[model samples]
Target: MGVDGSDRGEGAGQLLADGEAQISLRQAEIAAAADALRAGGLVLLPTETVYGLGADAANPAAVAAIFEAKGRPRFNPLIAHVADLETAARIAQLDDRAYALARAFWPGPLTIVAPIRDANAVCDLARAGLDTVAIRVPGHPVSHAVLEAFGGAVVAPSANRSGRPSPTTFADAVAETGDKAAAALDGGPCAVGLESTVVSVLEGQPRLLRPGAVTRVQLQQIVGPLAEADDDAKRSPGRLALHYAPDAPVRINAKAPEAGEAYLAFGGGAGGERVFNLSPTGDLAEAAANLFSFLRAADRTKPSAIAVAPIPEDGLGEAINDRLRRAAGFIG
Candidate 1:
């Protein structure tokens, strides 16, 4: 597929280098990125959580390309990103709980998985052939513009290669999958550096599949005593045993850095060249935004391991600790 059904000069995989793929948030660039998606090509765009590798949700070949490019497991479903709640309804059969959550968190960093409404809106491969589909309305202006320009649902997973940390900065996104995308939107650094909190409303009770910028407490207020993901975990992405990992191993809840370990401090207690504080003031929101970038930076130092300071398991800290536990391959 190509522009107006005409062939593009090259396949998406043969696109230019990362530098050339980076596009600004100007109108022309956004239109070009949308065009790429229409022609069955991947587009790397920003979201409130992290940069996502996007493909037309309805295009089977285009969706397949995303899995191939990222080496992502097909069993792990992808989230269909839409511009508005109206578009989201076309793909997911949202119930009362889903609508309640969406009304409170749509156009933000919360993903709701519901029974499939319009099967044609999102392809089987994108949903991993499940009856449920994960959908979200991103808060980032750049991604919102692209979605409107594209005029349909776009299934986007984290732009990083399979199980690695999601790219919070545009540079890291380009480094991960820029070569495979037809175009990329540069939205600078993401504000919410974690992935969206995934919740499934398909069953009788709402379930939290994965944690992210949206805290459990925030979701609990809307849905009331959310259930934990059991077999339903297969309906969500980022549920793998090992995820958001860096090149070096990670050690969580460490008091201080070891001889060769890089310290990821929570409160501003540690100092030194090797130590990277998540937040100088012990702010959970600040730590959440700084999590992935700090992990990437600490990994670049080539330390034997990355030791993380204890983060309170409340509100946003819950999401942060979840990521750390996954990074250390402790829990799924």
Candidate 2:
């Protein structure tokens, strides 16, 4: 298979030799990555959403390594990535609602938070000592292959350091956390290019903890009207007020960029080195896929601040604007 999860071609072998993604390394790299995780080592692997820094979910020491590597707060919880729904059921108690959502979105980018059925399956440190556990079945071929090879749950958060934009490309993932990993499997760029939509089903009605590739509209169609995350529902990650931020200050809803500001345009009214169009034709999905990558690129220029065009608040736009607001230090 190719690094992008497609069929390998003539130049496939050269990818590994040139230190790019190894087209033939799917099975070999997955095996090595799983071995590292089983031995309490960190592995940088790709997911459809973003690159993740992964460790054995059951190993407290391994889980701690992830926290230390990312400089993530101990209070923030981690999500366990499983190969299939069956594996998720073993660790988390799935009610009818959780099962319904899982059946519809598993092997995709939707995380379900539920009561812990087997506390030992995911360590207390990984769960932040909460009775609830957040679990997801990632759709990325390389990540799924590693989970299948590891034969258990793995806690994988975005590979980048805490409070930074998530890594979407293989190069960005490696630049962020490659030094701390024992192995890495580059699956090229992420398809979804955003984190999983997290929903907590521990109470009467499912609440949306964090938005991502899976929109509220899509989730509501499966589980009825969703509730917002309350104070007690702090079991999910990405809750920091100033999270997913870059070094430069972010200014949203800008009509035009100033002399020294980097511009993140949506519809098609910007140009030059500092200007990056999320989507030339105003497509939300394309905008989301380019969000973090463009943010990182703009930050590299050391601009005074980054100016963003206004994004509508419907469908995937909610998730995109959610990250933008957080980047600008306006939302939690």
Candidate 3:
């Protein structure tokens, strides 16, 4: 805890000011980040979706520090990142559907929640002592390299303080987590910009716990129909009623921005003095990656309220709306 927050350093709060922390996508930096994880310390690394505060998944003490660093609730389980499918098979009991999806989307942004085997090394604290574990193989090269170098599972949740938007850039990761990370690997901006699409295959049928860049339609093709996970399940991560909130109140699906409101437009510009467009060309993929960054920008303007343009509830839009609904709860 003295330097790396290793032995229960929940006190490793934000120590660096704005622009003070830096992470470059270099071999030396990646090697140092991997070393930190191996030593029971936390490091912020890039993923295809968003930056994650990574810790040794097999070490309960290291996992606890992740909650301490982000002030994240213990009820939410963390996702285990694996280097390859061989590593994932050792941790989870992969069924036919699980095998199908993993083959379709490994080394990508899809998280599969499967029944945890007794042989798995992931700690109970990382899975909230549940029988199921959420697992994914990130597509980002930086994350993949670190996982290979670390040589074990790493539980990585979004690298942001609880209730705030996830960090999409290295700067964003530093601004949110501060010196909690012993080191960070800058892999530029995240491609998806949202968390992974979590599919729980624990039950008889497949369930979609959280939406991301992976569209519902794509999953349907491989596994017929998908059911939305129950609210009482509490088995998956990112299921809270109020999450990804900014400092200011957020209002979604506003036909037009009211007076004194900062408009957050999706397809085009909103008729407001201050406006930030998610995707002017109506591209859902681009909008998904830009969601949190734009929200953080709009919050800095100190508007009376943040009004959002209507977003289509298809494909990546589903994930975008999910975050918006949770952020609006900041007002409720």
Residue pairs in collision within model 2 = none
Query: In model 2, which regions exceed 4 Å deviation?
Result: 1-25
lDDT of 3 by residue, 1-332 (tens): 00111000111111111112332325577688889998999988888788899999999999999999889999899999988778998999989999888877776788889989743479999999888888987776667778888888999999999889998888889898858988877767876788988998976679988887677898899898988787425777887778998888899999778877888897764444578888989998888888999898889888889899999998788899999998888311
lDDT of 2 by residue, 1-332 (tens): 32332111112122223423443455676788899999999999887788999999999999999899999999999999998889999999999999998877766778899999999999999999999999998766677778888999999999999999999998998899999999987777776677888999977779999998778988898899988999645788987878889999999999889989999999976678899999999999889888999999999999999999999899888888888888889764
Candidate 3: residue 245 lDDT (0-100): 89
1 or 3: which has the higher lDDT? 1
- Each model's C-alpha lDDT? 0.85, 0.85, 0.80
Question: How high a TM-score does candidate 1 get?
Answer: 0.92
Poorly placed runs, candidate 1 (over 4 Å): 1-25
What 10-residue stretch in candidate 1 is worst by lDDT? Answer: 1-10
Q: Rank the candidates by lDDT, best first.
A: 1, 2, 3
Q: How does each model score on TM-score?
A: 0.92, 0.93, 0.89
Question: Residues 2-100, candidate 1, lDDT per residue (tens digit)?
Answer: 010000112111221121233242779889999999999999998778899999999999999999999998888999999888999877898888888
By summed lDDT, the worst window of 10 consecutive residues in model 3 runs over: 1-10
Better structure of 1 and 2 per TM-score: 2
